[model samples]
Target: MTRGKLFEVAKELLNRELLDKDKCYMLDCHTEIFVWMGRCTSMTERKSSISATEDFLRNEGRSTSTHVTLLTEGLETARFKSNFVNWPKKEELKLYEEGRGKVAAMFKQHGYDVKELLEDDHEPLINCRGTIKVLQVNSGEAYLIPLPDQSKLFSGDCYIVQYTYPGKGRDENLFYAWFGRASQMEDRVDALSHMYAIADSTRGFPTLAQVYQDNEPEQFFSVFQTLIVFKGGKSSRYKKLIAETGMPDETFDETKTALFRVQGKNSNNMQAIQVDQVSSSLNSSYCYILQTGLSVFAWIGNLSSTEDHELLDRMIEIINPTWQPVSIREGSEPDIFWQALGGKTEYPKEKKVKQYIEGPHLFAVTLIEGRQRILKEIYNFTQGDLTTEDVLILDCQSELYVWIGRLSSVTSKEAHILGQKFLEMDILCEGLPQETPMYMVVEGQEPPFFTRHFSWDPSQAIMHGNSFERKLSLLKGGSQQSEVSVRNSWPAGSRGGTPEGSRRNSISSNGRAKSASPIPNVLGVISCTSENQLPYSPSPAEVKLFAGSSPQNGSSDDSLAFASSPALQPMVPPDNVRVDQVEGSDASDNLSIYPYERLKVRSVDPVTGIDITRREAYLSEEEFREIFGITKTAFYQLPKWRQNKLKMSLHLF
Candidate 1:
């Protein structure tokens, strides 16, 4: 679609690969329009923004007064760049442009105007407004007959319905032979042979299908205006008549359009309601199956979830099992889809509820001494505010997101169950409905919806800086600090997801500072990940993972709170390394407080492929390699259990 013609791509499907350096694209984000021109684009193509916008507006039935902005590669706005996944840094653009001067020259000579405009022909033979004829056959031969009133049929008869689209360049015929349940087999065989004979002579070979009684497909019911069944068979009342045509010239009729909503969370509760075919009736929280003429489309709403998708899939199997149905997600609807809904208009962007839409609220979920525990809200937060050890919740209006770091104690399962309860509690506590859509995303898999809240520098994608940072550090005579800073240096009021206290950040609104103070060692006595711990107080615990009346404080209960993985703590320094530089490292017992069971065990030799009693880690990677032999990458490729077991066996844990 990026080669020459303008087209829409699903927001979920948009990524860096779609932005080819040799092509151009226009993203229509409802109210706003952005035209992206690649670096190697031709001069003619570069100046075609106005024409493109006009064509786009005229096609989409939008006003010409709508704003259209132009953007070039590498100089795109933060909002534009956030639309894609794994969006490359500007340095990658520079590198690609470094060797493309000659390629640009060659492209300028020909330009994009020479490219062919591609389109598909959609004139279907099995349409309602086309020429339709019915044939009746006994044991001998099939003969033409007049259309029966209400498509009334007798149980003892066999019939062939032949559909043709005349004077539309689609001369081929569409044939369907329907056999009644009580009809004789010999009569049905004779009808099919006669139907194919006429079809071969008419237009070489035509599209044909077989339909049995009581097993009609959606197309069968939709193609025919009405259907009625009787209890009798062939009689003397049968008469042959001329073929019939209804409103042949009026091809695109809205009366033939049907819209069905495929909704609900599970099979037992799912419903497919036949709603009015209009933009106003469209819901953003459900998938809709629309039938425009013979074409079918599955319009996926933005607010619909994975469960809805599965329901839509089942609905599709019933509505258009064999036919090719166009699957289009919300915001990327095709022009034809808009045409079916009488041109795009205002529609709900999310599931409507009694509660008013509000800005996001964040919470941290942490594990206490290897036990999952709930933490409270974080004030004045930022992307750099999320720690590697704690699980954070981002309540984005109607949508909620729970982000788990790579080193967080909460596994995907634990997050799905407990993180959900925490989100529900947060919403219910605030007097809002608990039916808001929730999603649990892991580190690096952060969707654009979640990432857009941050005003991220492409260079700061990783914990460490890019090559530019390394070069800058070299020029500054290297950093004097021994340990790397856990958070990025950013001021309040900068970047999206600036946490709950947007303008009320700890530092002055305009001042530059790290997102928050780095996590404190707390005398190495604290074992949990949270630095700003809020009390659960004396509330009754919802989950019985730990047995006690109170959950805010640690108890002697041995039961695991959802999981057994230990909560990540601050980076531990070796005994020889001095830690006074870090806050609260002056304590005599600088080592983190570990469970008594771990300190008493002997070192485990996991690499030796032997099952032994666990002990304090003593083998270094060099000794591990000398003893067993496996590269770090290979070890990483092993199953997570193997990797975690190896790490636990080593003193590293």
Candidate 2:
């Protein structure tokens, strides 16, 4: 009979539902037949073998039959006896004892103690109910060895064969020790084979071997502590394992009978093993052991559930080959593992403000009186250079004023850029309540050439101001003519000019100037008689007096002749002095030519009492108001002397 036939017979007998108590099972080796009772028992069974000729030699007197030969083998007698019996020569026995002692000493050095579970009274052979206890030397705790029932056993199963020497008690001769379930015997054998393969390589389990050689037993126990077992099934075995190992509750999945320990649960140190039944028909199972900290795996056969263990191990190995377990506090909550892996922090970054370059057309930013001011550099084309002019009017105020001369040198592109800059400056100064002011001054130029003023309009988001021509026409002496021209140029009912009734009468109905220094009478002159009567014409001597005294100089060469004239005597002082002498006369005294004096003046209308003169130079109401800081009513109420002073300041005299 072959070994395979013997294994088949053993399996069939062991799986039998019932057996006769009187029957017997036997295994036939070439030289003898090993026999055992058919019924199973809990006690240590004996190994009894009969000679091949014993059946024929049995006498008829024997009442009971010999054990049945259920299995057969074709091995040599001495080799078969050595396997089942424990008899050896003294020399070989000594060598065997020495090797056993050396192996036991090696186990002890690595934190493990080997102890026999069966006593001398029990036969240390096949079918014995004995085990071996592999205890932790320091803690004296047994390992949770896997069993056939998917449960764990504290002690490991041991198979020992003992021999009886002459006149001596039974002595142990041969022995074998193993951990894990009987069903997983093949896997254990495979694992040992793989370990041998590793030992044959250049680099073996050096760290594992060193622990034992160095006698560092305590450290060896730590390697087993990191081991976690996952028994796969529909039961709650994994939960039980977690509880027994004191693992975190989050590690186990009861439904899947799986266990997983991520980097940041209760602890970082962890290892795992999974045992699963793969084929019921073949009665075969698979076991996988994973060293998560080192990203190492050891297994045999295909696992039923590969999602949790196999893929994660492969991923970790690929992503972090040199990863080592982190030593975290026992009850700490898991931090995000990927963040640590990616070397990132939790805090956010700070935001920064935008910056821009300063240019000639750009505005200067300043804070004054708790208010922000965007001061622009305004060129005064009329004043030649802004630095030489008193353009910084009303200092120490919330509002900023800048005199920008006619931006003649500014290109369209520069203007556009400056406009955008000013817009941004306005946005920056949104905190300020008052608007900043920019003045475009063209001195001595009237109407369209008058100073253009601008103010930041927050609602519009643009610098808004009145046109230079329109504002000038609204303020100074020639406004009536400009208004007439504007009204005529526009279509009837157009939305232009002041409404007809809204125009203010500069002259009173009494045919006399309503205010002192009334809009300068460029077209006609009015003379008052001693009787307060209006004179239509002046005498020859009067014409000569006025002709000699040019409007520019306000002085006549024939002053003595004028003094002698009776008509002028009452109007002019006896000292040949004239009333309403131009204020700021000293400032204009050196002027040889006046641009405004060249303008052609038309005669005044007799019926309408309107001046038709086309005055070239003038100031607008807004300009006049800004210059003297006065309202129309206030200007009219001022004394003639002060009024003249303001008019000269405006260059309106």
Candidate 3:
């Protein structure tokens, strides 16, 4: 689509009270179409067009005259109003017989102009070849005025006239034309004139590109500054406008240029500057200025006096000053301008991780690629022995690991880079031990079975292996030892290890499971027996089958370990039990377990986040009283600050 058509559609959409729901439609109909059409290459063009259209309509003034212009020859018989409804066909038309007469009539009745032509012997009106002009013809008067001479005018220079529109083709384009002084006019085909036509095609209203050219910079000067001022505020509207301008906020440096200044309170002698809606009644008046190629604000007056107008005049003088306007000075110290206003500690910035060899510190380095890997390989070479003595190897591959390991500490950032270096290699050609301690065999000693073939193969690293479980399996322990397990509560009396409260578990020949506790152990295994077996074997969907432990046979002569303790008695009857489907519960949960300290339970709190750990649950009255005893009377007697002090000292009590 032409820029004009797109603009027209945009204008119609923008004028309406856009609802939240209309945004998607706007993107689909307007934004996406322009992108698909390839009309909007950069954000600048679309943003500038939208802004110009909005501003043009917002600032549009009522026209003082109703007359319209038309271009035609000065022949009497050629003038008539019948041509308004139908035009003489282009190929078959004769000028005096139809075209000239029809166009002239409209000019006589209304007022029209021929911008660049005169009546001649051959044609009704013809001057320069292929040239158009503006004409002024009233019912009683007839004459034409040629376009002004601008051979010497410079680019960006413009003029407005009380001129009328020419004939049809001219009206389609020429909203306004710009011209340069003679020597600067570029070659005469009215290239400057085409700018206006381009601008006119854009819909809604004319923009700087349509109504004024870069040569006509004056038309934009005051309005341009005003646009920036309007956009330079903290409000959401101003923020959006600022974004539309494509100007970075950091570019508006205040140090070198006095673009903005805040006026003192009680300043009523201001000119056109508007007050911020939020604090309009404040004592000080804030005046913004665009003096040295940047935007800044200044406080113009105080409560005792009103000197706002005087200050504005002074500022304008600084900006425009003498009749010969000079270019504003650009800022030299870009670093200062770009520096954040509130000092360095403003936002969270990336930090380099640190690595340390000994103490409580442990770091992992993943090898990336490059010479860094070679350096890391050199360090791994000396892993056969580690001694307190410091050893130094200068870029040499021999005795590298022992020399580096002696260093007191290293930053995590260096370790991370080293890790990246390690990953860049192929096979197990080179390797370096991470800051994390790994058991290594001495040069002449036999390595343990578990460590026998452990190679530093980056490709074979397991991302989610349960190292704790693997290590637990490798640990030496008692014969017929119980598997490392986890329980909601202590396994009967194992917590404090009391005698009469001791818990006993029984195992049978088969791999059946059983748990009989006061609470039915919430979710624990049950052994299968012919006489006392559950009516049906628990399906996978029903009860979870645990590994390791089996059920005991019901023979009286047997140890009957399941009945050795009173605490093992089942508290809940089978009829009252409700079973939730084991949807995503992990089967690994029934495998080798972990110690209590390593286990975690999670509960959700809808409004907050997941509340884990048994300690988060509600406490009984006695428990609450026990916690409050330390603060009992002191909290009530203390002042608010002291109370806060005590509360913040959470562990001191």
lDDT of each: 0.50, 0.25, 0.24
Q: For model 3, how does the per-residue alpha-carbon lDDT over 585-650 read when each residue is reduced to its tens digit?
A: 132233332222222222232212311111212223343234433323333343322322222212
For candidate 1, lDDT tens digit of each residue in 1-653? 34346676566857878877777788877665677777677656755654666677898899754655555565464445556665654323332322233333443353321111112222212335566787777656776777643255555577877766432233435566777655666777776677666655664224455566655434444445334444335622221111132212211233478677775435433445555678988878788888787788988988777888988878667544674778998889889888988998997664532222223556665443333354545545566555444577776545566777655545554554544455444322333234344455554334334555554332233332322222234344554222222223222111123233233333322232323212221101112223343222212323333345133454333322433434433222223322222211132123333332333324342333211222112233454343225543355454433333334323233
Ranking according to lDDT, highest score first: 1, 2, 3
**lDDT tens readout by residue for model 2, 1-653:** 12111222442223222223333344444333344332222112212222222442253233232222211111112222233333222111011223334433543453321221111121111112223222111111123333332222111121111111111111111111123322123333333333223323312111111111111222122222233333321113433555587855433232332213221111122233333222111100222322333233332222222343343454334323653434222123133322223322332111111111111121222111111111323221121222211122211112222322221222112222223234332322222222222122211111110111212111111111112222233334323221111111322111112222221223222222232221111211122223322112221222222333432343333221122222211111122122232323232334333233232232232212222111211324454355456654565554433343234323343
- What TM-score goes with each of the models? 0.29, 0.14, 0.12
How far residue 20's Cα lies from its native spot in candidate 2, in Å, is: 10
Model 2 ranges off by over 4 Å: 1-23, 27-30, 36-226, 230-653
Best by TM-score: 1
Per-residue error (Å), model 1, residue 624: 42
